[model samples]
Target: MLIHPEEILETINMVTHEHLDIRTVTMGINLRGCSHPDVATFNENIYSRIMRCAENLVRTTEDIQSLYGIPIINKRISVTPIAIVAESCQVDDYCSVAETLDRAAQQAGIDFIGGFSALVQKGMTPGDLKLINSIPQALATTKKVCSSVNVATTKAGINMDAVAMMGHIIKQTAELTRDRAGIGCAKLVIFANAPDDNPFMAGAFHGIGEPDCVINVGVSGPGVVNSAVRALQNPSLGDISECIKKTAFKITRMGEMVGKEVARRLNAQFGVLDLSLAPTPAVGDSVAAILEAMGLESCGTHGTTAALALLNDAVKKGGAMASSSVGGLSGAFIPVSEDEGMIRAVQRGSLSLDKLEAMTCVCSVGLDMIAVPGDTSPATISAIIADEMAIGMINKKTTAVRIIPAPGTKVGDMVEFGGLLGTAPVMPVHNFSSETFIARGGRIPAPIQSLTN
Candidate 1:
């Protein structure tokens, strides 16, 4: 894992000028072993387990960052999905468990802790129902806890019942934290065909198949990609794509090297490297800017989906060449709020809900970090989610939605979340009712694509 002297300088340039950084070095801890029927006992075991496992996570990440002169932006933890672990406990509310996770994350000095979640792609169990009900209070009260629910899978099909419930849950979560601009909704996601080893927030959780403990890395370099694109002078489409691939190869190599070092220091198994060019609020560090750099007038304008398809495919191909193990949501994330270019596009009236939905077909996550009107009906939200889930289920790709129904907000108003969450402009939803469609609560059978031998 020796980096050449010249490669070190290139890495330095990527960090200093292009904002290249390791987005997260997430440690996944399985809590299945700690499950207990008693709520209080389960809470104690959960807290102690996380604290003991991730006590040195922050310090170790800092040491590695200083050693490599690379900025590691977030140190995080993703545990086994809470719904599964809490199923044994006879609890009416899983809010206490969420509090335990928050406290453990705070004690360990991690930025965020994921896995206050359930998978109801087929149907809901008593514990899954309880955890879903607790999401509103859990997100509102916890400082750094994140929740996700998988309501659809390619094999199990679309769970209309779960999808319908999530719409109400999302709105309630937003309403509960309306004072903070409905920030709670930013920490919750609904997914279809969700990946198990994702290290990104709002959708990250250690799957049942994962080992007891592991280290997963999420690498980000939107700015680097932007810079690479900018350096090109009137290049053709094929030339530009090749340039992106080379840049991605180098970025993924650095991520793999850093991930191995972190896993070794923590005595944990190295899992996967997520090569998602996740955008930020910063000017140059945006996925939309990269798209614009490819000659698009705006991110949501015509040809945006085709451009995203190219970028997503190139990054995956290049990263695959650099690392033996690459998984998770490995693509460009086009979250409107998180990406400055996308926010500008929305503000200018070029990006609409429909166009964003179209882009999600090729992007990382669906309807991510979007803000809708407070008056938006729960059934409409469910319908929106159903559309997105159907896309993923049919295509056999991961798709997720994290929409914020900011209370008392309209299409033009802006809600500033600051930091990484950024500010969101409330976008208008279609004024049509889909109540009847959502009321048909049952499983939408799996797509024919799922019958792969």
Candidate 2:
């Protein structure tokens, strides 16, 4: 853990000048004990269990932050998917449970609460169906609630029905809260082979196999990485690998320290340290900046994929060197609104949805922060999700889509979600129809690699 004086100066400069800080250090708490056959009993069990499990999360996180002097930007909780506990309840009962969970998060002083989720990678259970149906209302009515749906997997392929339903649900969710439709989308994520113990949102949840309680840290420093790249920008330089390598090393060290301290304070096992360079609306804290530093004027350009590929690789290598356990989507993110560089790129017409999709092949997630016509057909959105999931299934990498269809807004209109969720200018989609392709409601067959002789 010894850092040289020069390296320390560089790190300090990165943090002070750039917007470098740990995005979140989430503690995952399994809530299986909250299950009960009786609806009322189950509801009570859920509130009590979450309250007991997460009661110390905020305090423990604060203590660790004080001891380490490194900012743990978010003290968060992820629990077992509510769908699992609401099996016996009606749809209305599920919404009630969401309200209770939201209240518990507020009471516990947490900014966000995750795991209002359903896993329908293969097929939807009755409870799963009910929960999915209630997501729009639940999300609109409740504050601080996040939701995720896993509709695809490497072995099972994509569930078109579930995908289609989610498309309509996302639109309905937006319609229910037109002013904050994008906020619901910001809180919602659709995944292929989603992980249970991911400390990143809005997809994080305590996996069933994990212990009852454990601490996981998601350390972000896109600003740090971008600074290193900027230092190497001599205008005459050809390759930027060295800058990426060095920056990743420092970023991983920060993650390692934060993860260990949080785990120690909680008296829980230290889970993976996710070295994701997540961004905020603040200046200089951008994945797009890292890309621009690599000589691309904008992130969605042809060179963007090459830039992200190197960044993603260097991050994994450096994080792996710093910690034995490094998981989560430990790569760069290109969310349009969250990063100022990305927003400008979109405004200038330098970034497009198609180019963003290309970047996602090498980056962390897919089509994040993208906006389309408010009246865009549900089937079209489903097609987009299916296309992204198909990439993850074939490549066997974790990829997700978080798209917002701003209600009553058309292309070129801006929709603001406020706070860290930020504002996104509506982007255009292809007017060309994909109705026939999307309407063919069947699963995309598993990738060829799935067959084992």
Candidate 3:
């Protein structure tokens, strides 16, 4: 993991001008040992264990940032899913668990703490149900805590019951946090085929198969990729793809260096380097802009999907070549609110909900950071999750939905969530009803592709 000084010097301009940086350095801490029968004891065990493990995470990241002269945007922690860790506790409500995690994260000086989660892809246990029921309150009460629920998987198919419940849970979370334009929903994600080593927030959790302590990194370089593409004058499609692959290789190498240094300092195992092109609100640093640079007039146009597929494949191939430990959702991300270019596309009516859904088939994650109207029905939201879940289940890829039913907002209105969360223009969903469709709560069997064995 030791990089040469010349290699460090080579990335000076990319760091100084092109917005290439380690998006997140997440420490995964297994909390299975913290489980206890008493609720108070369980909380105490988790809080003490997390504090002991992650007390120096922020400072270590800061030291690495100063030593390497590379910006690390976020230092985060992912614990074993609370549904599994807290099942032994006697408590019915998990809001206290969420608050404990939030306090520990604040005390440790980290950005966010994930693992307020449940895995109910096949069927819900009593503990899973308890954790799921507490999500609305947990997210509403905790600022730095993030939650996710995996309601479907490639092997287990789609769980329509959990899907239906999550729709209602999302609505309730929005209502509880209406003052902030339902920002609580922004911290919640519904997933299908969630990865074990993802470092990004709102969908990150330490999986059961992971080590007791591990370090994972997420790298983003949309601006660098865009610059590479724009540097080529009247290039063919093959030329653009090659340029992206080279740029992605450089970006992933930098990320691996950062991740390994952080792991070494913290005395933790280096897990994986996620080379997802996660964009921000900043101008010129957008995945959508990269697509547009490939000759698309707008992001969600006719040829947009084909362009995105090329970008996604090239990024994966290049990143895989750069690092042997590449994992997570290592592809392009199409989060609407987080990308300024995506916001502009939606504002110009060039991007619609249907188009975004179509693009998710090739993208890293699915239906990310999209805002819909307050009056949208839970059934419609469930239908949306179902569609995204089906895509993941059939394709055997990780997909997720992080949609916000912004309270009191309609189409064309903007809900501003400053700093990384960014602003979202309310996109319109279909007006048709899906009540009966959602009401038939049963498992959608796994696709034929799942029979790989």
Candidate 4:
């Protein structure tokens, strides 16, 4: 299947308001074999295996970009959860492992490394506890390292202990590097039903069932959708739906071509095309821009909800029609640091944590790229996670929180993660405490909507 020159140009015209393309195509690698009782050997094996598996990732990605003429913005690696492998090691070993992974990514010329994580929703084991405790220093001292803590799942419910722990960890991470606390948050994600083969960071990790090597494509085009919506001078639901369908179809076609080519180069099987509407710092290439096109004065206003609902539905409809294998969180993202529109909204005092959550009800993820006060308590952060998870559980959609508690920073402070992840101004959180409710710590039963015939 080839995209004709004329067709490609038309799609380009609709999408490229500026120079933003798909941001990343991450490959998740499982490293269970890297575990060894001997700490020194364990570190060596982990680094060597990752280097061997990902050595050609960057080169292969470069070749595909040249061939397709579509800029593949990021080349990243996600490994198996480190906590599982570090079970036999001491607490200090977490830093060594993290440093090794960070160096490997840097050596390989990759931008980010994910799966420095622990899955403690059910409960924490010795290794899980150690890894969790090491997060603050592990994050502060390393470059290119991303972390995640999965504290809830549909089957297991939420782990209040883990949730509370992560809240404190976030604070510690911020305090360690108050200047870059928001940057640390950009590398961390809190998840529910987090996918194993996700090719996006700060949440990607190799699942247990994934093959030894495989290629997955994450295709984004908020610019395209925004342009389509902008062209509809006087729009109705039908008109808006049609525009989204067409734009998603074109974007998926690009993803399909890229995925096949990358798989061919790496000698690996091609996986799903993630039709996620990921945004960037470029002008007009933003999820917030799409909202503005829907007639909102700015993002985070009352009209933002209706605008996001329309944009989300349209993207899904279009993507579903383009590819039968649509997976991942294939919807619009409103990461504050990453998107220029979102950054501007935060700076303008237009967007808040609550408004961000409201938008997540319709968009892809929840409470993404938000920065709060450094002194915010762990229970409060857990409360934030609980609130976001409630949306996912009730709506039966995947939602997550990636909040940054910049240490020593308060409302109105700004922190930069740099590069594609971008910069963000700290936003305020609700001052009230949710300790009593969060301390209750039990499974929130499945919503009534989840029950069927």
The deviation in Å at residue 65 for candidate 1 is 0.2
User: All candidates' lDDT scores?
Assistant: 0.93, 0.81, 0.95, 0.80
* Model 2: lowest-lDDT 10 consecutive positions: 233-242
Better of 2 and 4 by lDDT: 2
On residues 1-453, what C-alpha lDDT tens digit does candidate 2 reach at each position? 787998777666766787666778787877787777777777688778778777888887788777755677887888888888678664454788888889889988888888899988888999899889989888888888888999898888888888888889888887887876556777889998787668888888777788887888888887777777787647443346656666777777887787787777667788878888888888878888888988887777778888788888877777777777788788787788788888888888889888888888887877787778888888888888988998888887778988988877887787787877777889987787777877787788788866755
* Tens-place lDDT digits, model 3, residues 234-287: 999999999999999999998999999999989999999999999989898999
Which residue pairs clash in candidate 2? none
lDDT against true structure, model 4? 0.80
Off by over 4 Å in 2: 1-3, 90-93, 233-239
**lDDT of residue 256 for candidate 1:** 93
Q: Ranking under TM-score, best-scoring first?
A: 1, 3, 2, 4
Per-prediction backbone clash count: 0, 0, 0, 2
Question: Which has the greatest lDDT?
Answer: 3
lDDT of 1 at 108: 95
RMSD of 4: 2.3
lDDT of 2 at 423: 74
The better candidate by lDDT, 1 or 3, is 3
